[model samples]
Structures are given as structure tokens and as C-alpha cells.
Target: MENFVLILLAIVIGYIINRLNIFSKDAPTILNQFAIYISLPAMILLQIPKLSFSIDMIIPIIVAWIVMFISAILILVLSKFFSFSKEITGSLMLVSILTNSSFLGIPIINAYMGESAMPYVLVYDQLGTFIALATYGTFIASYYSNKNKITFKIMTLKVLTFPPFLSLIVALFLIGVEFNPVITKVLSSFASTIVPVALVAVGLQLQLRLPREEIKPFSVALIVKLIIAPLIAFIICKIFAWDNQASIVSIMEAGMAPMITAGAIASMAGLAPRLSTAIVGYGIIISFITTGFLFKIIS
Candidate 1:
């Protein structure tokens, strides 16, 4: 509850700062760079080393990918049906296919399902969403934004060179090793900055009023992300008879809003920048109600 409140407060503060024009136009870019290059890597180094992979953990990961894959296909079909341009289609793919499974998922799930569900949340984020962000996300950004033909080698190189992905690789090898107390504390401090820094960055870019052309894409993104995606997860859980805590957490994660970083990537790639920000901003606000409704249905 406290963490959820903090997210809202940080967003409000960022919105206020933007409205006052207290920061330069490049402020959000600087914050996002700090998050991607510094805080996100620190977080991976800090958390990934603590994870112990097991067969039991595969459920959430599998479900997360399934949801993303199905949703991505749906987005493609919808894009064709609506005759969306390449930029709008790319923006929808970034925001809707990826989910805010960590920053929002961890805290929100903790508040709803209690601390016992943390492991599943972490699994869904790191093994599923995080890896997808580094790999599939890089692919989306490169493939959609560029007019030139992108090759598999270029995609692999980008994933390998991504800061957080490199950190994740290093962190995996250090799983059994212990870190120095002082170093751990330093990493922890940096890791903690991702949430507020990211939310504030999102708020800084947020615009409530949408241009007329963006309404349909924005609406489609939110519906796919917050409602349709999770509903798919829930139905799969029933199909598999996964009536467990892990399944519950996975369902909630599937219901989360657009990934803030995904939106950042879309905007950075010049893929319908304003529309991307609007979906990410409003998606978070609306997901609160939608997630609550989902919890009642699934739980």
C-alpha cells in the first residue's frame, strides 16, 4: 500500500514539475538514461544473484511469454484491421506486448497477495519480461524503427551489448558467490532508484490530452495490455489447472499496465512518441481499477 502510494505521489510530483516547466526539455531523457545504464544494471546485479532457478519457477515464466506472444499477434492483426501506420503499429507493439511487471507488479502484488508471492513476481519479471525486453524489445526497436533490413546478427549483438542484459549474465555466474556487505549496500541503493526515477520519467513525458488521431491506437493498446492480455493468462491457468500462488501472481502481472521502459524505447525510436507516452501514462492510472477487477475475478 505504501509503495503504491509512493508511485502515485512520484507521478504527481513529476507532472507538477512538468507543468511548471521547471526542468529542461531533455530532463526525461537524462533520467531514462540513468535508469537504463545505472540503476537497472545495479538492480540486476543485486537481485539476479539471489535467484535459484527451479522447475517450480517455470510456470510464471511460461505464462508470461505465452501472454506476450499471443498479445503481440493480436496487435498485428488489429494494426492491419485498423490500417495503422508503421509507427503506430510499432508503438503498440512496444507498450502493449511488454508489461510493467516489476516496478508496479512487485509492489502492487505485495499489497494484494502478501509477501509470500514475491518469488513468483520476481520470476515473472526477470526470467520472462526482463529477458524479453532485452531481446525481443531490441528486435522491435531495430526492426520497426529502421527502414533498412535488420539481420539476426545485428539483433543478437544489440542484446549482448545491452547494459542490463550483460549485468544479468554476470549476475547469473555470481549466484552462489556472496558479495561484500558494503558493495551489496551500494548496489541496493542504486537498485532502489529505478521505481521513482522511472515513474517520474513517465510522468514527465505524460500528456492527458490526446490528439484525435491517437485515440484509437491508445485505446487499443490499453485494452490489449490491461484486459485482454490478462484474460488470456487467466484462461490458460484454468486450462492448466494452475490454481496456485504462482499462477495468481502471473495473472496479476499479465494485467499490469504498459512497461514504462517500453514506452521510453518507443518514444526514443520516434515511433509515435506522443501516442506512446499517452498510453503508458493513462494505462498506469486505468490499470488500478482494471487490476482490482481482475483480482476479484481470478482470486
Candidate 2:
């Protein structure tokens, strides 16, 4: 309960800072980069080496993939009835298929389940959502834009070259190795900044007000992300009889907001940038309520 309060406080502080214009508009981007390139990798390095590898570890990744595939199929079928344009369809695909698993999921899991859950969260984000974004996400972007053709080489390169993904590889390699005390301490220091900084970055980027026309599309995307996706995860868990903390965490992660990076990708692909941004923004707000509800039910 205390951790939940702290999470809210950090978000409020960040929102206050943004409302006051205490930081430049670029502040959120810089903070996000710092979390991605520096703090997040540091956290991964510190945590991943300690996790025992198991078949269960891969469940989160599978759950993520299942959610993405299901979402895609549903959207395609729904488009037949809804008369959505190519751009709107593309934007919905990006928003519903990907999630803010890293920035938002990490903190929420940490707050509720603590650092012991970090390994599963990392697996869900890196192996699961990140891989989907690189491969499936790029394909959707390319398909909508009709610009650059996506290839396996391009998708593989994106995943392989990501800093945190590389860190995961290095961490796995060092699983049985010992690190010097000083080096471990330094990594710990950097890792410690991840949650607070990430939450603040989230607050800075969050946008609540949207044009009325956008509300319908944004709500549709949010229902898939915050409601349907998690429900799918829950059913998958039940069907597999995977009753464990990691499985629960994966469900919660599925309910996270639309991926912020996915929004940027959508815009660059000439999809509906305004709608994408609004989905990301409003989705973050709704996620707080949905995540809290999930946590209560799970607990």
C-alpha cells in the first residue's frame, strides 16, 4: 500500500513539474532516453544474472505474443464491420498490440511485488513486447506507410541492437560469474534511478485532453489494451494451469498503457499521429485504474 502511494506521489510530482513548466518540453524525452539506455540496462544487469532459468520464465513472453496475435486478428475482423481507414487500423494495431510494459509495468510490479519480480518483468518486456515491437510492429508500420519494406534482417537488427536486449545477453552470460563489489554497487546506483525517473517521464508525457472525435478511437484502443488483453492473459494462465506470481505479473503487464515508442513509430509511419498520441496519453491515465483493480483482484 505504501509503495502504491509512493508511485502515485512520484507521478503527481512529475505532473506538477510539467504543469509549472519547470522543465523544457524535451525533458521527458531526455529522461526516457536515460531510463532506456542507462538505468534500465543497469537494472537488467543487476537482476537478470540472479534469476534461475526455467520454462516458466518464458510464459510471459508467450502470453505477450498471444495477446499481440489475438489483437491483430480481432482488429482485422472488426475492421470489416467498422469501416476503419488504413491509418486508423494501423494506429489501433500499434496501440493494442504493444504495451508500456517497461516504463509502467516495471514500476507497478516493483511497487506491488518488489524486486524479486524484476526478472519476470524483464522477460515480459524484452523478450515479449520488445521483440513484438521490432518484428510485428515494424511490419505494421511498413504496411501502413507503404514506404520501406520490412525484412527479417531489419527486425532482427532492431532487437539485437537494442541496449537492454544486449544487456540481457551479457547478464545471462555472467550468470555464474562473480562481480567485484565496487562494480556491483555502481550498477545498483544506476538501477535505483529507474522507477522514479521512469514514472516522472510518464507523467511528463501524459496528455488527458483530446479532441472529441479522437475519444472514440482512443477508447476502443484502451479497451483492447487495458481490458481485453489482460482478460486474454488470465484465460491463458487458467488454461495452462500456470498459477504463479510471474503469470500474474504477466497479466498485469498486459493491461499497461499503449507503448509510448509505438506511438512515435506510428507517427513516423504516416499513420494517425494525433490519434496515436492521444491513445498513449489517455491510455496511461486509464491504466492506473485498471492496474489497481487487477492488483486488488489478484491479491
Candidate 3:
């Protein structure tokens, strides 16, 4: 609970900084790039090598893919009723499919379930959500942009060149090798900045004053993300009879708010920037309440 409170406090601090105009508008972008390229990759390199391989490790990835495809299909069917613009639809796909599984999910699991849950959290983020973001996410962003043509080569290159993904590859190779304690400590020190930096960056970028027109689509997207997605994960766990602790963590991670990077992806792709930002900002606020309720129920 202290950990979760710290996460929220970091966000609040960032928000206050933004409100006070303490930094330029570009501060969030710079912070995001730093987290993605430096802190996040270091964190992955430190954690992934320590993880023992297991078939169970793949379940979280499978759950993520299931949610992504299911959300896509649902969005396609509901598009008719909503009469959403191409940009709004694209933003919806990004938010609903991807999750804040790493930044928010890790802390929540660590607080509630302890170090035992770390390996599963790492798998869900690195193998599952990360891959989905690099591949399917890129495809959706490009497809919706309509301005830039997406090629198979481009998509493959995006995945291969992503810093964290590259770090994951390196970590896998070093899995069984022992590292000097000093080196490991150094890496861990750099890695430790990820969560707070990420949350602060999210807060800096967040805009709570949403446009009236976007509320309906945003609400539906959150429903798929925070509600329906986890319900599906719970059902999957029951059917597969996964380990109880892993299943609970998986469900809770699935229930996380929209991905922080989703808005950046949408904006870069020339999709609905306003809608994407609105979803991310509002989603994070609401998730505080929803995830707390979920933790209570599952506990």
C-alpha cells in the first residue's frame, strides 16, 4: 500500500509541477524518451536475466493477445453504432488493446503479492504487452494514420530496434550467467527510476478537461480495458486452471488502465490526439479507484 501511495504521489507531484508551469511543455516528451530508451531497458536487463523459464511464463502473453484481438473485433462491430472517425477508432484500438502492465501493474502486484509475483509481472510486460505494442500497435497506428504507408519491413524493424526488446534478447542470453554483485547493483540503481519517472511523465502529459464529444467513445474504451478485459482473463484462468497467485495477478494486471504510451503512438500516427490523451488521463484517475476495488475482491 505504501508503494501504491508513492506511485500516486509521484503523479500528483508531476501534475503540480505542470500546473505551476515549472517546465516547458516538452518536458513530458523528454522524460518519456528517457524512460523508454534508458531506464526501461536497464530495468528489463536487470530483471529478465533473473527469471527462470517456464511454460507458465507464456500465459500472460497469451492473455494479452486474446484481449487485443477480442477488443479489435469488438471495436469493429461497434464502430457502426458509434460512427466514430478513423482517428477516434484508431485511438480506441490502441488504448483498449495495450495496458499499463509494466509501470502500474508491477507496483500493484509487488505491493499486494510480494516478490513472488515479480517474474509473472515481468513476463506480462516484456513478452506480452511490449511485443503487442511494437507489432500490433505499430500496425494499428500506421493503418489509422492513412498518411504513412506501413510495410512489413517497417513493422519488423520497429520491433527489432526497440531498445527494451533488444535488452530482453540480451538478458535471455545472459540468463544462466552470474553477474558481479556490484554490476547488478549498478544496473538495479539505474533501473529503479522507471516507475516514478514514468508516472511523473504521465502526469505531465495528462489533460483532464476532456471534450464533450469524446466522452462516449472514451467511456466505451475504458469499459473494454478496465472491466471486460479482466473479466475475460479471469475466465481464461478458470478454464486453464492456472496457478492461483499468477491468475490473480494476471487478472489484476489485465484490469490496469490504458497504456501511457498509447496517446503518444496515436499522436505520432496522426490519429485522434485529443481522444487518446483524454482516455489516458481519465483512465489513470479512474483506475486508482477501480484497481483498489479489484484488489479487495481478489484478496
- Give per-residue lDDT, candidate 2, residue 41: 98
RMSD (Cα, Å) of model 2: 1.7
RMSD (CA, Å), candidate 3 to true, equals: 1.7
Residue 95 lDDT in candidate 3: 85
Quote the positional error of residue 135 for candidate 1 in Å: 4.0
RMSD for all candidates, in order, please: 2.8, 1.7, 1.7
Ranking by lDDT: 2, 1, 3
The reply for model 1, stretches above 4 Å from the true place, is 113-119, 141-148, 176-180, 268-270
Evaluated with lDDT, which candidate comes out highest? 2
lDDT tens digits, residue span 1-299, model 1: 78779778878888898999999999888987898789878877876676576655688998999999999999999999999999999999999999998767866787788756765776688778987887788788878999546577866786778787688778878876789999999998997788788778767877776788789999999999999999999998899988888899999999999998898899888899999988988888898799889999888
On a 0 to 100 scale, what is the lDDT of residue 208 in model 2?
65
> Where does candidate 1 clash, by residue pair?
none
Give per-residue CA lDDT, model 2, range 178-230, as digits (tens). 78999899999999898889888878877666778766667778888899889
Backbone atom clashes (below 3 Å) for every candidate: 0, 0, 0
In model 2, the runs with Cα more than 4 Å from the true position are: none
lDDT score at residue 161, model 3, on the 0-100 scale: 91
Off by over 4 Å in 3: none
Q: How close is candidate 2 to the true structure, as a TM-score?
A: 0.94
**lDDT values of the candidates?**
0.85, 0.87, 0.82
